[model samples]
Target chain A: MFWQVFLFRVALVAALVIPTPFFLTQAHADENLWGYVYGTDTLPAGANEIYLWTTSRNQKGKGNYRAWDTQLEFEHGFTDRFQASLYLNGRSHQISGGALAEDPDRRLHRGLEFDGFNVEFKYNVLSVYKDLFGLSLYIEPEYQRIDKISGERVNGFGLESKLILQKNFFDDQLALAYNLTLEPEWKKFQATGERERELELEHTVGVSYRFLPHWFAGVEGRYHAVYPEFKKRESDAYFLGPNIHYAAERWWFTFTFLPQVSGNPRIAGRNSNGRQLSENERYEYRFKIAFNF
Target chain B: MGLLSNFDQLTCALSLSSVRRIYQAGDLADDLVKCRLVVLRIKIGFPRQGVIMRTAQWIWLPAACLPVAAISIPAYAATYLTVEQAQQTIFPGEKLAPANIMLTNEQAREIERRSDANVRRKDIKLWKVANGGYFIVDEVVGKHEFITYAVGLNADGTVKQIEIMTYRESYGYEVRNADWRAQLAGKNAAAPLKLNKDIKNISGATLSCRHIADGVKRILATYEIALK
Candidate 1:
């Protein structure tokens, strides 16, 4: 029981610091600023808005982890049909273990990480007949900074881009959207205790559906290929998750789960004989609460 | 795999098909802590369960049933617009006495809609007495306006008072700004009001003075039918 709590805290901390700005931006896009008027199903022109969010996650295991995310988001409507936004996401994670870790004395570890907080501009390239359905293409350029994390620490700029396809049916009763992004990451890691630059690649695909007002559900999958500064080692990671959201009158909540779909160990250095070490992976059940003005 | 284990836990929380399937799932008693997390998500995710559409109908149903709700929501109820009754009660075309009447539901709705659209003078309202006296109700000044020395009938269809309310005119000088309202003293159904040159119209404030005189004239028409 104690171990599960520890794992929950650790997983939450990592998810919170991921700098996933698009999630926070999308939440405010359709909400109204004035209480009387209903917000639109499509982004309104010349509309500028702000949002703040906090997210946490936990894993069901011998250890538990908790994470926190805080972000300030700004979006501007260039035209009635086009809009752009910038989001700044920062987060920290805390991990504790009762028995989840092989090292029983590993009581706690805290680390802060930030993702690519990019300025993304979106244009409504085309609208279907009667503007019933539309397609939007957006490009985001970002700089990611990482302060603490073993083997993953880097201070480098990255470019993340997304193409979204959206459709509205049943007279706006339902909305289905698909989002795809290719996030390129580079970091300066230390080999032989000396700084070295390493390159990484990530691809993400997500689908969201709003079956009811103020409520939406989605699923996302990510493939991360992590290469070391030196050619001696190789590792890869995978995450797939279900995300659910509810929002009403200045309040929003979200929950998600990513159980770490794949983690294959790397072959150790030539000198070690048949000994293995299990690396840390991000496996979490997450929750988020947000308020907007 | 780690993912498979978490998936199993989620399925256990979401699937309620069989009691045995839930309890017999491995470590049900032990993994109750994990199960609690799943339940929290389900509970907070009420909006995703299509509750918004259901709640919208519920809240709008009661309000639309009140007055112009039919015009707003389109289904639950409609306004009672008896045009003939309104014609007789609000604007009776009787020669002897004009109908001084209260507003009908449709008229009230029109006033509200117009006021909202105008935004500048949203505080305007119209009031009616039981008997048949219609007064220009200006809540802005916290007072009522009627013809000078004019008798207002009560709700029971009897003459209530004979008072000179005001005679402020905005246009002409036939009737001075201060004395224009004094012309209607002691006027009743027995003495029809003549708000023309014979009666006296303010020179620059003619339009305003005429409004007061015409207002009294219209009220007399309402009184004729309401009293009968």
Candidate 2:
């Protein structure tokens, strides 16, 4: 009886802590200036979810501002442990108080296919053991066509692979996680001599507390190392953010702020002429709302 | 005094003492005798009414009388009822026994009819994503559809599982974000799945999070109702 009780408790802790590593790449549009992805852990089979959020980010020195991004997401379980989902996001950036002054017409940018969308498939590879640990794998790739300031159209596909690790301590009230993200992009520039490919690797570590029933707060710091093969000089950006979330019976909401603490300087301009890039990173504020059926 | 008279008096005293001891040890003790005498006293004074007479007349009889009659009636009653009637009314079948659990064909058809009726009644617009799964949009926002899905959670609301029943959006990037959903495994369902909360908001996919979280809440609500 004693061993059984101990095992049960251990299993509960595993269920809460493990299986987090598989969901690390998909970010809420509220906190990120970029679009949204749909790969996350499978909702319990037969369960479903919808999430929406918007956010804006600014450079640390208040230049190179990104506009608010809107996101809508839906996910469902087809079995007891496996789940699938579809997600869509639209983003518009404004050069508010930034060096790119002539970029006021964000709509023209949209015509270049600034918006991106993708589909995701996920499976709970393992969750039935002791429930102490869970495993899942997801794959997602997206494409968007955008017009640069030089009037050149760029079509790019972003491929991302993420590993999420969830660990629990102190009777399942506290959870710690490490997430690794790999993003590779293929870009084709129209009528431009610039190389049309770029890649970024992002790593983040986070800890969350189940402070109240269906409520949680956590802090995550991410380091994004951009390796632009087109541009020889590599750059890395760092962000620190605090998040607040509320999940109700049929809906959920989230808010967060991420300040770009550090970044590398842009060595040279490829498509744009006579442009001076800022050395400082950007800041972001985000909010999201979601409902389930 | 004469010798014979004295002997007779001694014998009478001895006999009385033996009787007293026997009464104390046996069922005819003082408490029983008192209780019996009280009952007799009450019975003697009661009027000859039918109700009182019924008890007065029955109490003196043997205590085994009613039990014997009760036992005999059940035996006779069991023999009289038909097998079907006995099976239905007399006893619940044991584990080894077989019983009917079949539904009529009409009833089965009725269930299917109701399911189709529900599908026709709701405003659901379905779309197939390029990667996988069909999206059912019950609500429309601008040109995009606001899709909803369910997230099954445990008692603590940690994500036990997830299901996407409806959606209409880009499938590639959104579908790739599927792994990101695991971040919600330990989240509190009563709270919001915000970036500022315990979850890590994805860089490009914040908008998708909102729709997914909303769908999760709806699913949890259904689970709650079912539990009750």
Candidate 3:
């Protein structure tokens, strides 16, 4: 157990620092400029990068709640216009005595576990400099062995696709981005032997300013609408947040804090402060770092 | 043996500057001759035997082959132009007197303020043309590389010509197109000089275009405030 923790830490640190020779080049554009919003830039041909992200979901209106979701990603550019990535995701949550867990039989959950794997691809269709604006199409398929929220054993599959758009102004110091995403997921719960399907419609808008050299400050807003079993609307949630980003020659970090501003959830019998606590957390904090070679 | 002796010096030349300088200034015959020279030296150093020369057969051979391999990589990333060549190409039959000037922080700040572009360096490499214009060598951060380019300004502060001096890019080669660069000509400080407005944009080259456009704008602003 100690070695597992130690080796994991060491491997992450080594990944962040070992590729010093990549110092000759700058971070590729495909490196996420925002925490949640997608940028339309693709990596140069033959370039590769590694990304690690940790997001903390906090508060659920009742009881103590905190969950950490971590994802380690490896991305590569096959061509100047196309890029792909693989992600390994893990989650640890402590939700005690709350409706945060959808199943009453699993109200309290704890412990960390490997949860999911995902593959993503991006194709650039237009360049912000060469064309009127930038555009890219993205597709990702994810497989989950454990539930992210309830910490229950399950088999889940999801396909998420997005259309990313970007436009820069003020000498490219200020950038605006929008992403439209559609995701559908299927899950079979081991505890109840129940099957569920969900379709989520999401959109994000972001604007960032390069406040200082290698540093950026921005705000992003996200809206999510979900339908269970592809039926009527089951929930509505919106989040708004601020993010700060700093990028060096070989590495970059982006931190964002998003709080649920409004939502209507069916779980927990009621909504808290007009915010959905059953389906989403009261606030989420994410820190992402990426290294390129 | 000669190749082994020159081996130490050969690896040092692998530095990007020296390698690119050699590759840019060399022709096919010249570059291949260097490659073959290393190979021939190693060939001579190998000892001939009667039956099977297996003792030192592959040993030390790879070390000698290193330089030969390095020399064969064509200069695809970085390309350059000498300052003299740039001056002559921009202004033929005109004498350019070296009039390099250093910008004070205040002047640089003012240029940045007027152009709305950040100033990374304050030292400007400038020359005064015998004709009524000026030539300035400048560099801007491309999408991933530092693009060194030269700009000529007419006496009235309008751009005369722009020449890329040193270009290194993994992608976004469209910025090097003559037509893309030519659009910046005849523009002055007052021009919008913004991407997709006064100057057109090329896909996959947005940052390159923005930085180069901002660079030209900064130079024009410099001319308006300091040089004028």
Candidate 4:
């Protein structure tokens, strides 16, 4: 009887608190300053926004390669520290001979294909405004039938979660953010009945300065490691670059040009200058635009 | 890796994160000690299953904090003061009576032309002092929020003091500094009231500074045309 009562109380509390953010009465913040890093800020309550992202991954240090990914995201703020989003994902890649067709290699994508979708939730425990430092927890669950790199039809499911931290200075003229992310995925091929489990750990940091009222400039760095089948570390990559952002009244756009600084490719000798190329691209340029309503 | 590990412990503390105890710049030194303690906690908690970094990071960590020693983050918000408090603070022993004024379109346009500031509203919120001075409440657009401030003028129509009643922008909180507001005191309609010229502009809060300066100028023009 005691255990049953405890479970009932827990379920009742969860039911009441889980739906509080969906009321959509007030909205707070709708601007993003970095391309790859996230800040621990949220909308007030009852606000809606749309975001469009275009990311270009180019150059593999060997053979001409290019990939463009697009995501149409709809975001809603339930409260000051809680928000949710839905995404429509699309991906296209072009590669001309870099030993991807070799044995034990993966399939490559050539044209535009619609990938699966992703649902994201974020909750802030602390904010930079009143707290010593800002901290937020973010989680996204993704399901994809097409491989992002190979574009082959496969059953892939991924769960990505991150801890975001932010700090501001100089009357919010200078802002810094950091994110630690872990993603675990499982994929199974329908044609060959092949199974794969992968784990990824990533750390990203961004420092931005509002040089002008409507303009912000920053630099971001990312270090990520991939573990195939959750065993040995397969590859590790480093990226660093500059980002620029412009915010209007209800719309804002941020762009970043990140180049792979160094990495361990561990691919069929397709590395460039000892940098990872086959598994990771030489550079990534991402542009994001958001509209608040 | 070490910094990320530090954040994990910090998250536990953030879970208790109702920041009801925050201080201004005067208490920044104590805050630095708190930050160092947090970093110390991170160092103490860095023994994981596989990661080993006890000596190598300790030797270089102090030098890494040199750049961070200069940073201080403060929150900006609305609701700095209220009208009754501002009235008492500006006009200590004297009583003030409501002397609100309404302006015609031509008069508003004329005030705008003379002061180079837009007259946002026709009806002005003001009060007349027993000593023949006045107090006015006005609002101006900031980058993202609206700023409401009160200006107290002298009997001769010059600015006596400027008080920021509420400032809700992401930047430009420095406009509330008494030293900066001192520049506006004793200035009449002959003053330029231009930001970065007669009035020093805050580095990040340019819009707030400019708008407040423009509002002051318009208020002076209003006194000359409507209240004088």
Candidate 5:
């Protein structure tokens, strides 16, 4: 089943990439301006960039769990309307002393592990510079290996897509952006020979004000929903935060912090008392630094 | 190997200021031929290797097209309108004399405080019409750039016409539209010329509209107190 899913994802990516090179014969240029929380714009044709980012998520639970994810990405613009990127991802975890900390089996070891890889493509359908609201489409495929602390392994594959929209007002001093994302994943447990499938939908909205020449400040809100077997709605979450961005001629940086306001954990029956409980995260923070060449 | 050696020499020659100066002086025909020969030699040296040759071709192709692209872009004249042209358009063939008005620091501050906009220049030019009116040229900040415009007021202090002299912003060129400028006509110092209230804003040119409106208000006040 995992092999079938992986093959299907690979085929889909191939279908999209096959016809791209035929139209990439010309080179053009455009601005690469962006907002902090949501991807609101595309790079110019023939532009190339490298990005490095890190995210930390803290969860308040039995053992005070914390997870860190890091990614390095190479992005290129094939034309004025299309962009492609590849990401190398990794993760690390740490647990503090608490209810589940005494059990070595329940606590995660503190170390970095190779997570997986993802390929992303984006196409701009409408441009704001041409007196219209901006619209873009995004598609991505991801593969991951769940590394074991002692000797447990799980693997997963996923496909995600998004519709992004943006608009500018007050002579480009203020910008508003929105994104809707859908993802489906298949996970296989090697030891149990069991497989599980899940679907997720997420919505994000952001507003930014260009306060200075190269500085922008904004706020973002996010809503996440999960479905088991693509049928029953199992859980949901909401997060809101502030973000800041700084852009220069050759490079840019952005930082954001989000705190989960409400949500229920999917595996509520696994709690100590076997009661349905909230699984909302305490906070999450991310920083990205990118360079254009 | 000989081609590789010539490629190195070609790069060194292109990097020299003397070669650039010679090109600027209109004597680069011979040097251009040498450069072309070096490029041809490099291409011929790797003809059998398709991948390497294609990579080299892509690198030089855009470089060769740069001059054409640069020359193809259209150039516009300077954006400013001279005092004579501005007076002629505002008064239509009427002889107008230029008078320089220097504002006191207190008066400049008073104008800024009343209009809620920055007053960058204290010295202003007022064109006195022989018949009866004042033509004033002023500038205001519009989204990191200055927008220069001319304001004409009748001797009775009512606005006659407003014409944009130079607009420096890439976007919000809609502020230069005549319909938008006509909104301020007939407004006087006693009338409120606030943006979004008295002067309807253009859809995508809000900042420019607001700044220009505020500037018109300030100019009206200046005329009322100093020149009227």
Candidate 6:
């Protein structure tokens, strides 16, 4: 009941904020790059945009394991060097087989549900056209509720930040971007009232080339590391992918497919009951479409 | 191996020939070289990818495939019009005397303050037609590129015609249409000349339309103070 009321309030806030007529303009070309590699380019001052995206992760193991997340984002550029965005996120999980098979109530249920809300701000420190490389700082704060397979709920509050750098060559035809991200999260279990903390560090490098007027092809490599208690290194993974982007005057779409090239052993340890704790996903795919008004 | 060498030599020769022509054009040599280099990199990069894919089997097949693709890749070309061509198109067969006007810092600032467009340069090219009219050339920034245009005015300081000489942006080419350019005709110094008011904007070409309209307003103001 509390979750329901919180979700209604978030939806109401989104409704009230979206209709404010502040500004409108066409989207930029570099804005269609991969999600992990934030572009150092900002829209012209007083420009507004809306972006919609879906991400699917396919885990390799057992029976039918996948996760899907969908998000809606509204962004506005208040000044040439400052921009802010709001996001509403939702997720779905497909869990079949494994230990959950023994429990009738937790056996096989796959459906989508509301997840959370996030607010982000980005400030450009240097412009690529004026400086050697573009540099920007970004921060996002998020609140989410996760529904587990055992009918338990976990609520989390998290903060993520990134330092983004980008450079363009050949009259903006070729672009290279790098991002270093850090996130700290705190979660509280509703059932047991237990709290946990986690820290994550991620680095991503991407390169894109505009082969045609509206088409761009690129590749990105990412390295992710996690610490459960902020002190001990728990796990790490590497992902590499190819991305393609297409943009018209007022709309754009981008798709990326990332396969985990390497990671810590999936079967890291076993519980006292001899059940193995496997690693995360094997591959992920993302699709994003955006419209400028 | 022989065929591969020949193909490389052929591309080099073709690139050099185009470079020679660019040099002959003279004014835009540096810009042309930069644009050509970008195109050449893409053309060369794609063929190498194909070669890497089929390296073990039939190496020559990939080299053979290069000519068809390389020949079709068009260079980034920007059209340039000499002053003679612009005058002939604006005021056909009539000789125009060069009356280049140099603006003082205060004059440039006044024009910039009054107009919606930003004046990038201090000197404005003005031509006095044989019939006491004026032909003016100015450049305005549209998005990231510069758009050069020619404007002709009658002796009474009213617009006669406007012609877009060079447009560098990939989109918004519709601003070059005769019907859109015709709307600026007969607009005098006193007119509002504002976008969406006196001039209607093209749906997809809003930036180009607004910048061009703002540019015309600035030029008209320049004519009143400097050329009149």
lDDT tens string, model 3, B25-103? 5553347546444322222221222111111111122233323323432334455568899998889889999888888
Please provide, for model 2 over A1-293, each residue's C-alpha lDDT reduced to its tens digit, 9 standing for 90 to 100. 33432343233223222322332222221111111212123554445555454555443232334344444456666764455566564444434443343333323222101245666666655431113544556656776554223233566688777665555443333556666777777877755645556676778766666576556687767777766763554667677788765543333455566666656654233212221224223556666554344
Candidate 3 segments exceeding 4 Å error? A1-14, A20-27, A99-101, A104-110, A266-271, B1-127, B137-149, B153-205, B213-228
lDDT of 1 by residue, B1-228 (tens): 144343433223343323334545644744656554544323222122212221111112111222321122222111222333332433355222333345555544453343221111222223354335543322111001111323344444433432333322111223323355455644554444444533564332323344445444444433443333
A170-265: candidate 6 lDDT, tens digit per residue: 545578999999999888878779897888899999998887766779999988887888988787788899998765555566788887777764
Better of 2 and 3 by TM-score: 3
Best by TM-score: 3
Error (Å) of candidate 1 at residue A286 is: 4.8
Q: Of the candidates numbered 1 and 5, which has the greater TM-score value?
A: 5
Clashes of 4: 6
Over 4 Å off in model 2, which ranges?
A: A1-40, A60-64, A96-114, A126-129, A147-153, A190-195, A230-233, A266-281, B1-228
Instruction: Please list the residue runs of candidate 5 whose C-alpha ends up more than 4 Å from where it truly belongs after superposition.
Output: A1-37, A96-105, A147-153, A190-192, A265-280, B1-228
Model 4, chain A: how large is the TM-score? 0.86
Interface root mean square deviation for model 4, in Å? 18.4
lDDT of each: 0.41, 0.42, 0.74, 0.71, 0.62, 0.67
Error of 3 at A259 (Å): 0.6
DockQ of each: 0.02, 0.01, 0.04, 0.02, 0.03, 0.02
The runs of at least 3 residues in candidate 4 whose Cα sits more than 4 Å from the true structure, single-residue gaps closed, are A1-28, A99-109, A266-271, B1-148, B151-228
Instruction: Write the residue-wise lDDT of candidate 1 on A164-216 in tens digits.
Output: 56554432324445455555545554333435444444555544556454566
Q: Report residue A247 deviation for candidate 2 (angstroms).
A: 1.2
Candidate 1 lDDT at A137 equals 70
| Candidate 2 CAPRI category | incorrect
Candidate whose lDDT is highest: 3
DockQ score of candidate 2?
0.01
- B154-192 in candidate 5: lDDT tens per residue? 878888888888875434567778898888889987777
What is the C-alpha local distance difference test score of candidate 2? Answer: 0.42
lDDT of candidate 3 over A84-165, digit per residue (tens): 9998776666666654545444454443346678999999998765567889999999999777667677999999999999
Q: Tell me how far the alpha carbon of residue A277 in candidate 1 is from the true structure, in angstroms, after superposition.
A: 12
What stretches of model 6 exceed 4 Å from their correct place? A1-30, A99-108, A147-152, A268-279, B1-228
Sorted on lDDT, best first, the list reads 3, 4, 6, 5, 2, 1
- How high is the lDDT of residue A178 in model 6? 95
